[model samples]
Target: MNAREEILRRLGETPAEPAAYAAIPRPYLRRHHEGDAVELFAERAADYRAEVRRIPGADLPAVLGALRGHYVVPDGLPADWTAGADVVRDDPPVSIAALDALDGVITGCAVAIAETGTVVLDHGPGQGRRALTLVPDHHVVVVESARIAADVPEALERLSPDRPLTFISGPSATSDIELSRVEGVHGPRRLTIVITD
Candidate 1:
């Protein structure tokens, strides 16, 4: 019999034993100390070669100015948050392409998973479209401790299935046959996450 038919035949002969499926061991859960989210995020980002920064809400303007590039696409970010930067509107048909041509992308995150050091984006207002972050060479994500979760499951619980979500662990990279790592293979070469209190 073919592989598919053989599998079906085996299934037909098997009894529905609940304990048979329960042989797998439960996953070990890690416990994080309180007040360690920010530190854990920084540590994980650094491990992945992403630059991490901490800034006050008011100093956001200054941080944007420091990043190189004449064009800046602020994803669904607030007007005041991008007042000084050159803003790209979403009305134009080529807006997505235009954003891809920009120097970098900046946006707010829906959640930050401390255990994985991952940032989750839901494309919410001031967060902009997913393409804005995907095509850029650099991505600067703003995360707040209030929205940081201790683990992936906790972060997933906060997200809805209806939204288009993007989870970023670090800068985009892939290894070649020679075992050399190449950055910016499919996404941004540089990733910077700024955590605010």
Candidate 2:
């Protein structure tokens, strides 16, 4: 038989109705503990070798000044936040290759999951697009105290489902090749977080 005739005969013999499946039940816990979320987050992030600093809003400029590197900042980032740092504004959007040549990218996060020590970015306002943060060798993020959530479920409540989300727990790394730990394989090698109260 010809290939086209055999395919048509098989198609005519197939069932027309779609199959149905049973629904699954979920009984997962939202939070494991109720300890101070911010403190726990700092401790957990540090465990992944991320440089974390917690300070009052007034002291932000000083902390930022200490980081010496050419960086890319989102257009919505506060002017005073990057007072002394050399920065490129992503107003026109930076090309992927150009971003790789920069020292780092600085941005503000959308929400933080304290339980997982993860910083979630929705690319809103001060948070730049994904490539801006991923291509650079280093990343410096500003996380507000008010936006921290005790756990993942709680954090989800504060975020929009449709937005592009990037969850960062630490500097990019992988140990998959030879079971040896390696950093900066998929993203930045260094991460600095400034938690503001």
Q: Using TM-score, give the best candidate's number.
A: 2
Task: List where candidate 2 sits over 4 angstroms from the true fold.
Answer: 1-28
List CA RMSD, all candidates: 5.6, 6.9
Report the Cα lDDT for candidate 2. Answer: 0.89
Q: Which portions of model 1 show Cα errors greater than 4 Å?
A: 1-35, 72-75
lDDT by residue (tens digit), candidate 2, 1-197:
99999999988885544332123334688787688888988888888889999999998887787777788999899989989788899989998888999999999999998888899999999998889889999999999889889999889979987899999999999897679999999999999989999
Model 2 TM-score? Answer: 0.83
Candidate 1 C-alpha lDDT tens digits along 104-151: 877788998888889998888767676777787888887877888887
Q: What number of clashing residue pairs does each candidate have, in the order they appear?
A: 5, 0
